[model samples]
Target chain A: MKLELGKLTIRDIRFSEESKISEGILYVSKEDLRRVALTEEKIKSADFDIARPGESVRITPVKDVVEPRVKTEGPGGIFPGFIAGVDTVGSGKTLALKGMAVVTTGPIVNFQEGVIDMSGPGADYTPFSKLLNLCVICEPVDNCEKHQYESALRMAGLKIASFVAGLGKDIAPEETETFETPDLLTGMKAFPELPRVAYVQMLQSQGLLHDTYVYGVDAKKILPTVLYPTESMDGAILSGNCVSACDKNPTYIHENNPIVEDLFKQHGKTINFVAHVITNENVFLADKERSSNQTAKLCKMLGLDAVIISEEGFGNPDTDLIMNCKKIEAEGIKTVIVTDEYAGRDGKSQSLADADKAADALVTAGNANQLVRLPKLDKVIGTMDYISKIAGSSDKALQSDGSIEVEIQVITGATSEVGFHTLSAR
Target chain B: MKELTILTNNPSLKESLTQKYPYLRCGIEYRDVNFLKLLELVRDEVHKGARILTHPLDGSVKPMETPYKSILVEKSDPGLDLNSLDLIENAIMSCRKFHFDERELQPRVIKDFQIIDRTLMESAIDTSGLY
Candidate 1:
C-alpha cells in the first residue's frame, strides 16, 4: 500500500463569512462549523473559538485534538469507520491542513481530562499550545448519560475536523510526501541486508471511557492484528479513551504518530519496517494473557529481528507491557518498550507496576508525576470548573492569584508515550 | 452459568448490579472502605481461592485519586490461584505509590468518580455474559 500525503501549511486561522483555505490562511465560518457539530441531537450547544501560538489562552477539560484532513483521492475517507464507509484506506492521495488542530473541550467527562495552556510555563509541556487551535466547546443536553455525552463529544470533534478539512480538498499542497509498504514477501526481499523491524502498539481498551476504535469497532472486541503502517496514517485507528491527558494518544497524534513517522524515515535504510502489530490492554487477566500471547506469536511469525513496543496508559497496562516484552523476548526477538513514568512527585518510586528483566531496552517519555506551576492566562476557552478535579491536580489547584500548580499529567501531550513531544531525561 | 462475585466500594454500583441481576446468580459484596481498603478486601478474598475476573486497577484514574473501586472475582474456593494472588499483591503495592488526597474533593467530583467506576464494571459485566 502506498499513500501520497499532501500538506498545506496553515499560517493563520480566523472566522469569516465563508470557509476556505486561501494563501496559507484558513478562514472558517463559525455558524457552519457549529452546525456540523450540532448534527448530533445530544449536543445542546456548540461554540467556536480560536487560540494562537502565543496567546494568553487556556483550554481545559479537553477531550480530543484532531488535525484537519481530507482524502482527496482515496478508496476511503479520512476517518474510515465513523465518518466514512469501512473501505480499506491508505492508498491514493490525502491532503492535511498542517499547523492547525481542532481541539474539543466541554464539561469534564471524567477526572482524566486535560488542560492546554497556549502560553506561559504550562504551554511548554504540551505540543497543542504551539498549534493554531480551533476550539470546539460542546455542551450536552440535560440528563445525558456519561457515555452518551462522551460519544457525542467525540463525534462532534471528528465531524468538525472533517468539515474544516474539506476546505482544502481542491487547494494545491505546498509539500508532498509518499509512504509505501510492500507485501511481506516483497518487503523481505527488498531489504534482505537490513534488520527486520516492527512496531507493537498497545491500544487502551479497559472499559467504556478507556477505549480505542479501529474501523469503527471497539478494539477490545478484536484480537491482535497486523496492518500496513500507512493504515494508521490514513485514520485506520482513532482515540476514544479518556486516559491521562499527558500520555493519552489523541486523534491528532494517531493521525500524525511520531513513532510511525520516525520508523518510516529509517525504512529501507537501517531497518526493514515490516509491519504494525496492534493489541489491546483489557481489564481482565485472561484477556491480557491471550492478547500478549497472540502479539508475541505474530511478532515471531513475522520473522522479526527487533520490534519497538509502545503503551497507552500506565498501571494496569504496565502488566500487559511486561507480559508482551517477556513473551516476545522469549522468542529471541529484541524489544524496546516505550512508556511514561508515574515515578512519584519526587521521582523516587517504581516506574511501572510490573517489570521484568527482559524489559531492559526501554525508552521513557518523562514522568507524569513531576509537578509544574502554570501562570494565569488572560483568556480561558473552556470552563475551569473541573481543574481541581482533573488528574495530576489537587483541591488546592485553584489559587487566589489565578495560577495553578499541577503535575505535568494535567497538560495534554506532556509525556506522550509515542515521543510526540521533545521532553527527555538525562 | 459461571459463579461470579463483585466486590465494590461504590454503593451505587452495588445497588444497581444487585437490582439488575438475581442475588443468587450474581453476588454483590458492598464494603464501605477507601480505595486501598477495597483492594485489601479483594486480596483477602484471593487468598481464600477467589480468582480475579477483572483488573484491580482502573486504567484512567489513579488509585488514591478516586475513592471507589469495583473488582470482579470468581466464587471462593479452598485452593488458591497464584496468578490472582500475584495480581492482587501487585495492585496493592501500586496503589500505595500514588499519594493523591481525595478527601477534600467536592460532592460533584466524588459522584463523577462513582459513575466512572460503575461504568467500567458494567463494561466487564457486559462481556461476562452472566446476564
Candidate 2:
C-alpha cells in the first residue's frame, strides 16, 4: 500500500549562554531535492559563506535526508477497517457500534443488546476488533442469564434466515444480505425471504481469537471471534482516574517498569510508560510545563534515548509527537513509548497523540484535507472512502513535483467531548 | 631583552623569578603587594618593555574564590633569553589548558582522598516504595 507521507527536515539547535557563534541554515533535504542542489557533503566542504554575527550560516542544504514518500494511493471502499468503541462509564459505546452495524447492513437489525454496568472506561476494543469481524458485545458474562450471543442470533429473525438444502450449493443473491428481525421468521416486510445467519456459543479468553461458523444461505463460513471484557465495545476510551493518578512518581516508575529486563518482551513493539508526579491541586494546572522539564531531566539521567522525550512530552502541531517517534523508529529503535510525563491534561493529550501520530500523522499531517471535521459517523465512513480511493489510484501518492498530499478530516461526532483516543496499527 | 615578567604571590618567590628571567630584575617594588596587586605590577612591568621571569605562585597572579588559579608568567619582553624563557612559558601553557579549580587537575592530587564516601552515598540511595 502506498502510504502518503509528509516531508521531514531535521534541524538541531544548540545554544550558549550569550549568543550563537554558529548557526545552521534551513534547506530541503529530500533525495529529489538533491538532484537540484550539489551534494550536502560537497557543499559543506566549501566555505560556508562565513556567517555574519546574527545571520544563520547556511551549511550545505541538509541533503540526502530520507523522507517518507507515498508509494500508492489508498484503497477505495469501506477499506475493511475496524473501530475501537471506547467509552467511559455510562457512555453508549456498544450501542453505537451496534447502531453502526445496523446502518451498514441495511435492515432493522434488532439484536439482543447486552448491557453491562461498569465504573470506568470500557474494555480495550481495538484488540478484540482485530481478532474478530464480529463486534464483541461486552457484559458481565457470568451474571447475565440469557447468553447475549444466542439472543443476538434469535434477533436475526430465523424466518428471514434462508436454509440451503445441500451443504455446498450456491445460495440465491437475495439471501446474502438478510437482517434478522425479532418477529419475522421467513419473510421480511420488504424482502420475500430471509438471509442466512448463525448463532455461536463459545467462551473465549481476553485477547484470544476463537473460530466461529455462520450457517448462511449459500454455505457455511468460519470467521474469527474475540471475547471482550466489557459491554461498551467501542467509543472514546482513556485511562481511568485511578491509573492516571498512580502513573506519576519516579519511584512508581521504578517500581512498575521492569526496565531493561522487561523491555526485551516488547523490544520491537511500542511501549509507553507513564510516570505520575504528585502535586498540590494548585500546581496541577501549570503541571504540563513542570512535568515536561522533569521528564526531559529523568530521561537524560537514565542515559535513555533522547528521542524518548518526543514520546514523553507535549509539542506543537500535536502531531509532532507521533511523527518524531516515527523518525526514531525509522532509525532502527524498534519500539518507542513514553515512560513519563503522563500527569497534566496536556500530558494526556500528548500521550494519546504518541499512539495515533505514529501512523496517522505521517500519512495525514501534510494533507490539506486535514481541517474539515466531519460528524462522528461521517469520519469513520469517510476514512473508509479515503482509504479506498488511495488504494485504487495508480499515481504515486507522493508526487514527483515535491508537494505533500494529505486527506486529513476531523471526524466530528456527538462525542468529540470524550477527548483523545489511542489507536495503534500494530 | 625579555618582554615577559612574573610576579610572585609569595615574597620569597621573587628571588626565584629574578634567577629564572635574568633579563629583568625580580622582587617586590615593596608597594603593598598582594596576589592581585602583584599580578597588576607584572603586567605593567611587561608592558613597560622589561623582560621578566616568574613561578606558578607569582604574587601578581590572582585566584578567584576557586581554590586554584592559572599559574603562569607574563612576558614583558619577548626578545629575551629564549631557552629559559621557553621552559617557563611551556610550563604555564600546559597548566593553563588543564583545569585546576576545586576539582582535581591531576589524579595524583586526589589519589588518597575520598571523592565520595561509598557507605554514606549508598545510604542516600532511595529504597522507599515507589508510587
* TM, chain A, every candidate: 0.99, 0.20
For residue A208, model 1's alpha carbon misses the true position, in angstroms, by 1.1
Off by over 4 Å in 1: B1-3, B19-25
Point out the worst 10-residue segment of candidate 2 chain A by lDDT: A98-107
lDDT of 1 by residue, A1-426 (tens): 899999999999999999888999999999999899989889999999999989999998899999989999969998889999999888899999999999999765657899999989898999999899999999899988877888999999999999989998999899999999899999999999999999999998888888899989899888999988988888889988787899999999999988888899999999999998999988777788999999999999999999999999887899999999999999999999999998899999898888899999999999999999998899989888888878899987777899998999999999999999758775
Docking class of 2: incorrect
Which residue pairs in model 1 clash with each other?
A: none
Two-chain DockQ for model 2: 0.01
C-alpha RMSD of candidate 2: 33.0
TM-score of 1: 0.97
